[model samples]
Target: MSTTADQIAPAHDEHHAPRGLLRWLTTTNHKEIGTLYLVFSLTMFFVGGTMALIIRAELFQPGLQIVEPYFFNQMTTMHALVMIFGAVMPAFVGLANWLIPMMIGAPDMALPRMNNWSFWIMPFAFTLLLSTLFMDGGGPAGGWTLYPPLSLQTGAAFPFVILAIHMMGVSSVMGAINVIATILNLRAPGMTLMRMPLFVWTWLITAYLLIAVMPVLAGAVTMLLTDKYFGTSFFNAAGGGDPVMFQHIFWFFGHPEVYIMILPAFGIVSQIIPTFARKPLFGYASMVYATASIAFLSFIVWGHHMFTVGMPLAGELFFMYATMLIAVPTGVKVFNWMATMWRGSMTFETPMLFAVAFVVLFTIGGFSGLMLAIAPADFQYQDTYFVVAHFHYVLVPGAVFSIMAATYYWLPKWTGHMYDEKLGRLHFWCSAIGVNVLFFPQHFLGLAGMPRRIPDYALQFAGFNMISSIGAFLFGLSQLIFLWVVIKCIRGGEPAPAKPWEGAHGLEWTLPSPAPLHTFQTPPQIDPSEAHG
Candidate 1:
C-alpha cells in the first residue's frame, strides 16, 4: 500500500517502541498522552456520576433518607468538583491532545513531555480529593465554589481539598501552556490562523483562557487556605476582610471557567454540524470571532453571578448590560449553526443528533442565563433550584453532549472501527430525554422557592423535585450505554475508512484510520482549498 503524505512512513521510522505498560507510564508520544487523558477523564466521569447519583437518590424523596445531611452536602460538593475539574476539563484537554496536532498537520504537541506530565498529575490530585470522603469531617461541604467562611470549616479535608485544587490548577496551566504553544508554533506550512479548524481555533482561545484563569483560581484557593491555617485576613470578617470580596475574586475565575468548559464544545459542534450537514461551516470567520468575543465578554460578566452581593446601582447596571452583551456573540454562533444546517443535505447521524441537541439545549441554557443576567430578576432566582437548572443544562447537554458528538464523529478515526449505529442512536435518545427529565423541572422548583444545596426540601416543592430525581437517575444510568459503545469500538468492530463521514474535511481525514503513532513527522502540504473553514 502506498502511504499518503499525511501518514507517518513506517519504513523510515526510528521512534517505534516495543509494546508494554511502561510505554504508557513514561511515554512522551502525544497520541499516547492524549489517550491517557481521555481514559482518565472517562474514569472520573463515572466516579463523579456516582456522586451525582448519591445526591439524586437522597433528593429522591425530599427528606434525609439515604445519606446524612453533611454527607449529602459532601456528595453535592464533590460531584461538582469532580465533574468540572476531573471530568469535563480533562476530557476537552484529551480531545485537544488527540486532535489538534492531527488537524493542524503538526508532528506532535509543542511540548510533548509536559503533555504527559499534565495528564499524569490529574490522577494523584483526584485521588487526594476522593480520599477526603472518608476523612474526619467529611469532604468540603461548603460547595465547590469554596466560599471562604464555610470552606474554612472543612476540618482535615480543607487543606487536602485546597491542595487538590492547586494540583488541578497546576495541571491545567501546564496543559494550557502546551496547547497554546502547539497551536501557535506547530501548524504546517500554509496553515494560517484563519485556515485553522474551528476546533483548533477554539482550543487556541481556550488555552489562553485557561492560562489566564487557572492561576486566578489557584490564588483564590491559596488565600482561603491561608485564612484557615495561616491566619491571613483576606476573607476573614473579624480581621476586617469582607467575605463578598471573596465572591468577587472567585467569580472572576468562575465565570471564565464556565467558558473554558463550553468553548471547546462550540468547536466540536462547529466541526460535526458541517460534516453531517454536508456543508462547509457557515460564517467560519464569524465563528472564530464570536468565540473570541465570548471569551472577552466572559471576563466582564463575572458580576452577574454576584448580582445579589449588593453592589451599587452603577455597578449593577454595568454588569447587567455587560452580561446581556454576551448574547450577541452567542447568538451569532447559534445562527451560524442554524445557517449551516439551513437547507443542507442533513443526515441524522448520532453525532449530528447530539450536535443539534447541543444547539437547541445550550440555547435554552443561554436564555435562562440572560434571564439571570437581569440584576433585578436575579434577586428572586439567586440560590434557588432555578439557578441549579440553568448551569446543569449548559454543562450536561451543552458541554457533555458535544463531547459525545465528537467521540462518535471521530472515534472511527481514533480506533479504526465502526461503532454500532443503532446503539449510538439509542444512547443519544436516552441522554436527550433523560437530561431534560433531569434538569428541566429544576427550573420549576427554583421558581417555586426551593433552595439548592439543602438535603431536604419543604413539602410544597415535592412533586417537581421527585420528577427531577427520576430524570437524574435515568440520565445517570444512560451513561453506561456510552461506556459500552466506546469499549466495544476500541476492542473490535468492522473496519472504518480514513474518511469515515462522507462530508468530513480536514487533514485528519487525509491520514488512515487509527492514525499511525506518528503523523506529519514531515509537514504535509497544506492546501488551502482542502482545509475546513
Candidate 2:
C-alpha cells in the first residue's frame, strides 16, 4: 500500500510507523527524545520515591526497621541523586525538548543527534549507581552532596559514584549546549528576546547555568576521585587543601542547581496561569528581571548552605546578606503571579490546580529557605528534619508538581485524547493532601531537634514519624492515579481539538492534537510560531 498525503497514519500516533524499540533507540526526533526523557524521569520518580518510603518506614517507629544505618544512608544518597538528576532535571529537560522548538519557532533542537545521546546516557548513569548496592562496600553515603572525608572511604562503588556523576554531568552539558544554540541561533527572525515565551527565556538562562556549573561539578568530583586513587589533594586537607574549600566549589555549582530545578517551573506557571485565568501575564518585564536577578544572586549565595561549616563572621555576614537578597527577586515573581490572577477569569483544571498550589507552596519553601539563610538561626536548624521537610516541600510540590501539571495541561496536545477529568482531580487531591501529611510533621520534628540523614531517629520523634510514614505510603500510592490517567489517555480517549484549552496560546496550541513530525518548516510570520493558521 503506497502512502499518500490523504492517508491517515497507523494507530493515529503522532510519530507514525516508528516500529519496534529501534524507533526509540535510534531516534533523533525532538518529540521522541522528549518522550524518552519524560518516561525515564517518571520511572526514576517512583524509584526515588520508593527510597523515600523505605526511609520513612525505617523512621516509622524510631528504630531501624528495614536496613542497616550504612545502607540507609546509601538509600538517602541515591534517592536524592536519582530524584535530582534522574528525575526532576530530566523532567524539565524533557519539557524543553518537546516544547522549546515549538515555542521558539525552531524546526528542531540545534543538534538533534546529540539530543538523543544526551537522554540515552541517563539510564546508563543510573544503572551504574544502582549496581553499587551489590558492590563490595556499598554505595556513596555522603548524601547526594557527596561531601568529602565520608566520601573518601566508600568501597567499590565510590569510583563508580564519581563516574556516574561525571556521566550525568556530561549528558546535562550536552543537552544544555544544544538548547543554547537552538534558542540563540535558530529562532525566527524578529522573535526578539522579549517576545519569546518566558519558558524559552528561563530555559536559555538555565542552559547557560548548566554549561557553567556542570563543569565545576565535573572538576570537583574529578578532584575527589584523583585524591582517593591517584593521591592528589585538590580537596585533601592534609595537602593544605581545605575540605571547606571543596564545599565552596560544590555549592557554587549546587545553589545555581536549585534555580535550575525551579526555573522551568516558573516558565510553566507563566504559561498555565494565563490560560486558565484568561489574562496576560502580569509584570512580564518584572518577571524576566526577577528571574535573571535570582540567577545572578544564586551564584554568590552558595555559602548559605555552609552556615554551620565554621566560616569567619565576615564570611557569614556576607553570605547571609547575599542569600537574603534572593528573597526580593523571588517575591517579585510571587507578586506577579498573584497580580496575574488578581482580576481575571480562572479555571481549575488539573494543571491550574497544581500551578496555583505551586505558587503557594513554593513560596512557603522560599520562606523556609530564607529563614535557613539566616546564619545564626541555622546553627539551631542545621541538619535537622526541618531542612529535610523544607526541600521535599520545594521539590515534590515545586518541581514534581509542575511536571505533573504540565503533563495534564499538554496531554491532549501530545496524545490527541483528553485525560479523564474526574481521575485528574482525584490524582491532584490525593497527592496534594497526602504530600502535606507526609512532609508537614517533619517540620515539627526538625524544630524539636531531630537530626537528618541518621538511619534512625530518637525515640521521642516516634509519633510524628508514624504519621509521616502513613502519609508517605498514601502519597506514594496516589501517584498511580496519575499513571493511570496518562496511560488511559494515550491508549484511547475522546478526540481533542486544535486548541483544546479555550485560552491556550502559542504555536504548539495551533497544531492539531498529536503534533506533526515537521511543523513550521518554513517560518511564516515575524515571530514564526505566533503565525496563525
Candidate 3:
C-alpha cells in the first residue's frame, strides 16, 4: 500500500492511546472532538431546518394560518441565529477539526484540552438559546441581527439570548485560537504553508476572521443588554444614543459574518474540483489572495445590508461599489472551477453531484447579489423576499450544499463504507429541484413587491406563494432522504478502499478507510519521487 502520514510517523506522547471516557471528555484528540463538533452541528442543522419549515408553512398561503405575528417573528430571528451560529459556523469548525490534522500531518490539534472545551460549550449555549422559545414573550423577535428598540421591547428571554450569544462567542474564540495554534505549530517538518490543502488554507483564514470580529458582536449585544436593563441607551435616542449607531455596530460584525460562512466553501470547492477533475487547482496562489481580499472587503460593505435604514448618498454609493467589487475575486473562483472541469475526466458520484450543483446554483445567488449591489436597485430590494431568495441560493446551495458534498466525498474515509450512489443522486436531484422551486419564485414575488418578515400578503401574491409553499414542503422532506443515506452509510455498506476515487489526490487519501484514532501518530515520510506514482 502507498503510505501516508499515519503509517510513517512514530507514536508521540499519549495522543495515540485510547483510554477512558475522561480521555474523550477531556482529551485533545482532534479526531474525537472533531467528530463531536460535526455531530453537534448536524443536530443543530435539523433544529434550525425545522424552524425554517415552520416559516415556509406560515408563508404557504399568506393568510397567517400558523402562529401569531409575535411568535412568527421569534421563529425567524432564532432560525437565522441558530442556522448561522449553531449549524453553518460550527460545521466548518468541525471540518477543521477532522481534516486539518490529516491534511497537515499533525498528530492532533494544538491545545487539545481547549479543543474539548470549545466543542462542549456549544450545546449549553444553544440550550440557553432554545429555552427562550418557551419564555413569557417568546424568543428574540428583533431578528437575528437583533436591532435594538424592538429588541428592548421583547420578553425576559432577551437576557437569555444575549448570554447565549456571549457563550457562543466565547466558544468561537477558543476554537479559533486552537485552530491557529495547530496550523502554525503542528505541521509536519516538510509541509510548508503553500503545500497545505486549499481547505486547510481557507479554514486558516476563516478562523482568523472569527477571532477578529466576533467580539464586536459580543460588545454590541452586551450594549443592547445594558441599555435594556441599565437604562443607558447606546441605541436609544431618548437615552441620548443614536439608534443608527446600533446598525453601524451590528453590521460592522455582520458583513464579515457572511464571508466567514462562505470562504471555507471556496476552499472546499477548490479542493473537490481539482481532485475530481484530476488536475492541480488553477491559480492556487490567486485563490488564497482572493479569499483574503474578500475578507478585507467584508469590513467595508456592512452598510449594503443597511441601506434602507438611511445613510447619506455618499455613504450609500461608497458601500454599493465596495459591495459590487466582491464579484471580481468571486468571479475568479467560479472561473477556476470551470477551468478545472473544462477538459478532465469526471464522474458523477454523490459528492460530485453536490459539488457541481454548488457551482451552478451558488453562482445564481451571486448574480442576484450583484443585482442587489446596484445602489438604485437595492433601495427596492432591501428586506424583501428577493433578498431571501438570494441568500438561500448562496447558503443552502452554497455553504450547506458544499458541506453535504464534503460529507459524501469523505464519508467513505470516515466510516469505511461507500454510500449508495443511486440514492445519493436521487437526493441531489430532489434537493436541487426542490430548492429552486421553493426559492426561485420568491425572486419573482419580491420583484413583484412582496416584503419579507410579514405574516400576510395581498391577494396578488397568492398563487406563487402557494407554489413556493409546496416546494418548501418537498424540499423539507427530501432532506430526510439525505438523513437516511447518512445513517445507512455509517452503519453498513460495501467496504471502501484507500484512495477510493482514482482521480482523488491528497495526503488524507493515502490513509486507510476507517482511519485509526491515532493513525497519524507521527508525520508521513514524504518524497517527491513517491508522489508521482
Candidate 4:
C-alpha cells in the first residue's frame, strides 16, 4: 500500500527520513518538527478550549453550579495561559517551520538544532505549568498578567508558574532567532527580501518582536518571583514601591506580545486574500510599510492598555493618540485586501469565506479596540466584559480565523489530498456564526455593566451569558469537524496536483503535493517578474 508520494520525491529526498518513534526523537527535519508543533498545538487548543467550556458552563446560569469558585478561577487563569502560550504561539511557530524554508528556497533552517530544541522545550514547560493544578493551592489564579499581591497568593504553584513562563520565553526566543537567521541567510539567487512573500515578511518582523519582548516578560515574571519570595518589593506598596510600575512594565511587553500573536496572522490573510481573489496583492510596498509601521507603533501604544490607571492628562493624551494612529496602517491592510478583491474574479472557498469574515469581523474587533483607546471612554470599558469581548474578538476571530484559513489553503499541499469542501463550508459557517453569537453578546453585556473574569453574575446579565455559553459550546464542537477534516485528508482522498489552487503563487507550490521531506536543497532560481515585490 505504498502511496504515490512514495513513488515521487523532491530533489532533496535523496536520503529518506527515518521512520518510527526514534525518528521523531532524534531527527532534525523541519517538516517533521513542523508537524510535531502543529499536532501539539491542536492538542493544547482542545485542552484550552475545554477549560473555556468549563468556565462558560459555570457561567451558564447565574450562580456557581459546575465547579467550586477556587477551581473556576483556576480554569480561567489556566485557559488564557494555555491558549496564548500552548495554542496560538506554537501554531504560528509550526507554520513557520513548515513553510519558511520552502518559501525561502533553503534546504532547512539555518539553526536546525536550535529549532529542534526550541520546540522540544515547550512540552516540559507546559507540563510544569499544568501540573501546578495538582499542587496544594491550585494553579496560578492571578490572571495571565500575573499582577503582584494577587499573583503572590498562588501558594505552592507560583514558583512553578514563573519557571514555566521563563522556559516558554526561552523557547520563543530560540524559535525567533532561528527564523531571523534562516530568512536572512538562506534565500535563493534572485529571492531578495522585498520579493519574499508577505508571510515571510510578517514572520521576519514577528521574530524581532519576539526577541525583544520575551526577555522583558522573563524579567517581569522573575521580578515578580523575587517580590513574592525574596522580598524585593518591586511592586510592594508597603515597601514604597508602586504597583502601577508593574503595570507600566507588563504592558510594555504585553502590547508587543499582542502584535506577536497577530502579525503572522496579518501575513496569512494577506497571502490568502490575493490567491482567492485572483490578483497580485494590491499595494504590495505599502503593505510592507504598513506592517513595519504597525510593529513600530506597537511599542508606543502599551500605555493605552493602562489608561485607567491614574496617569497624568498628558500621558493619557499621548497614549490615546498613539493607539489611534495604529488604525492608519491597519486600515491600509484592510483596504488593500478589499482593493485586491474589488474587481477580481472572486471565488468563495472555505479559506476565502474565513478570510472575508476575518476582514469584516476583525474590523469590528479593531473598531472596539479604537473605542477602548480613548482614555475617557476606557474608564467605562476597562475591567468590563467589553475589554474581554474586545480582545477575544481580535484573537479568536482575528488570529484564529487566519489560522483556519491557512490550514484550509495549505492542507491539500501538505497532505496531497483535497479535504471535503461541503464539510469545510459547514465547519466555516458553524464557526463564523458561533463566533459572532459567542462574543457579540459580550459587547452588549459589557456596555450593560458586566465585569470580566467573574465566576458568577447578577440575574440582570444572565440571558446573554447563557447565549454566550451556548455559542461557546457550538463553537467548541465545530472544531471537532476541523479535526475530522484534517485527519481525513491526511489518510487519503483525490490526490492533489503540484499546484492545486490555480491562482496560488509561491516557491513552495512549485514542489510536489505533500511536499517532499526535503525541499529546495539546491536553491531554485527566482525570476524577478514572477516573484512578489
Q: Give me the displacement of residue 289 in model 3, in angstroms.
A: 1.1
Better of 1 and 2 by lDDT: 1
List the global CA lDDT of all models: 0.91, 0.87, 0.85, 0.90
Regions more than 4 Å wrong, model 4: 1-18
lDDT of 1: 0.91
lDDT of 2 by residue, 1-533 (tens): 12211122122344564778988997777887899999999999999988988888888897767899998999999999999999999999999999988776777777877888899899999999889988988888889988888788888899899899999999999999989987887786667788888888889889989998999999999999998999888778788777888889999999999899999999898888988998878888888889899888889999899999888999999999999999998899989889989988998999999999999988888888888988999999999999998998889889899899999998898888999999999999998899898999989999999999997778898899899989999899999999999999999999999888897777778677888776656653554434211
How do the residues 1-533 of candidate 4 rate in per-residue lDDT, one tens digit apiece?
12111123242343565568867875567888888889989999999999999999999999888899889889989999999999999999999999988887888777777777898999999999999999999998879988877888899999999999999999999999989988998888889899999999999999999999999999999899999889898999899887888888999999999999999999999888888888999998899899999999999989898887788999999999999999999999999999999998999999999999999999999999999998999999999999989999999999999988999988988889998899899999999999998999999999999999899999999999999999999999999999999999899998999888888888888999999878876789897765762
RMSD of model 2 against the true structure:
4.3
Residue range 1-533, candidate 1, lDDT tens digits: 12222333334343565458877887666777888888898899999999999988888886789889999899999999999999999999999999999999898888777777888899999999999999998889999998878888898999999999999999999999889988888899889999999999999999999999999999999999888888799999899998889899999999999999999999999999999899999999999999999999999988898888789999999999999999999999999999999999999999999999999999999999999999999999999999999999999999999999999998999999999999999999999999999999999999998999999989888888789889988888899999999999999999999998998889999999999888888889988887863
Candidate 1 steric clashes:
1
lDDT (Cα, 0-100) at 375 in candidate 3 = 85
Candidate 4 or 2, higher lDDT = 4
Superior candidate under TM-score, 2 versus 4:
4
Which structure is stronger by TM-score: 3 or 4?
4
**Candidate 4 residue 281 C-alpha distance from true site, Å:** 0.2
| Total backbone collisions for each predicted model | 1, 0, 2, 0
- List ranges where model 1 is wrong by over 4 Å: 1-18
The C-alpha local distance difference test score for the whole of candidate 2 amounts to: 0.87
Return the TM-score for each candidate structure: 0.97, 0.95, 0.95, 0.97
